[model samples]
Target: MKRKLCVAPSFNCDDDMEELNVAALSSRKESVAPLTAERDGTLFRHSLSYPLALVLRLRVLQIVCGISTLVMGSVAFIEERQKFNMGLGIPAGGFSILAAAVSIHTSRGWSLVTGGASVGAGAAGVLWIASGCLLIALIVQSCRTILDPSGLDNGDGEAIEDYRPSPRDLIVIACVQIVLAASTLFSAVVCARIDCTA
Candidate 1:
């Protein structure tokens, strides 16, 4: 007796396997994780609790400096009694006034611009001593504020809910102010010496 060879039919399931593979890939693509944290991960969100207070203080100081510069500019104009010098003083005063107004209006950009203009005018051979003194005061205040951080915090027993500038930051600001003051004073002395010899 001869035995017939048994054969099984081969099924075409390539399409089904392809579909399953596509589905698996799609699911994996949909399950991706975020690269960053949801909250407090943004750059601006870092240490923003006390920015308002700091801004306010800065604005006030800028206003004060601007006003002082304006006064000094006026004095310079009177002392010089020259048309060109008088015009310069008027513009400087106007800029200082504008800076004060901007600071009061809460426009930080304009205020900063005006503050810079006021300082520049002072540095350009007008009201040197007053500008130097103001800078010195600002530096001293910055140092005091930095060394005593408690003033920024609420004295209540509740949890501290605000950000106060660190002593280190204060020290840095102070150093910068001191440098500025010294430079202004030096410039003023040199100007005076030159004027005396001339």
Candidate 2:
């Protein structure tokens, strides 16, 4: 009877050991699952920072370009109306001013409101790209005007006079437009990358 009791106790102990091993394996799986999920979440969230940074950089450059254009346009309008290329200056200055304003608002996390509706990030990005394209076209036009020898003369049969865009001024305008174009292009690329990732 004592030998029978000892054998029964040994069988119970083997059962308990198997149960413990199963429990440990389940616990390990649960722990590893959460850890991998957390890592994946962090990676996805942080992956956007690179493109976002570029967008912000583009905004900053837009702001600077806007300010410069506004100032230059104001000066041309006030002091050099006769010599200023109104066709080029007006559009470039106007675009810059608008771009700066919108970029500033967007950078501050404000959404565009139309008919009491707010725009989404995707829509905003699309609008930004479109604006960038128009700005590039303006920049190209301005560059051509600067490079063309007969760009400064008024079309109403005006004689050559002291009031003319100096070579230095033309060069400066060309350079600024070039920089603006480059910045806009870079931002467009970043924005495109964001779209692709999405």
Tell me each candidate's TM-score: 0.31, 0.49
- For model 1, the superposed segments whose C-alpha errors exceed 4 Å read 1-126, 149-161
85-171 per-residue lDDT for model 1 (tens digits): 222333433443454344333332233434433323323333434444454554454455445533344556443434433445445
TM value for model 1: 0.31
For model 2, the local distance difference test gives 0.54
Root-mean-square deviation per candidate: 21.1, 12.8
Cα-based lDDT at residue 54, candidate 1: 43
State the RMSD for candidate 2: 12.8
Q: Which ranges of candidate 2 are over 4 A from the true structure? A: 1-51, 73-118, 121-126, 153-159
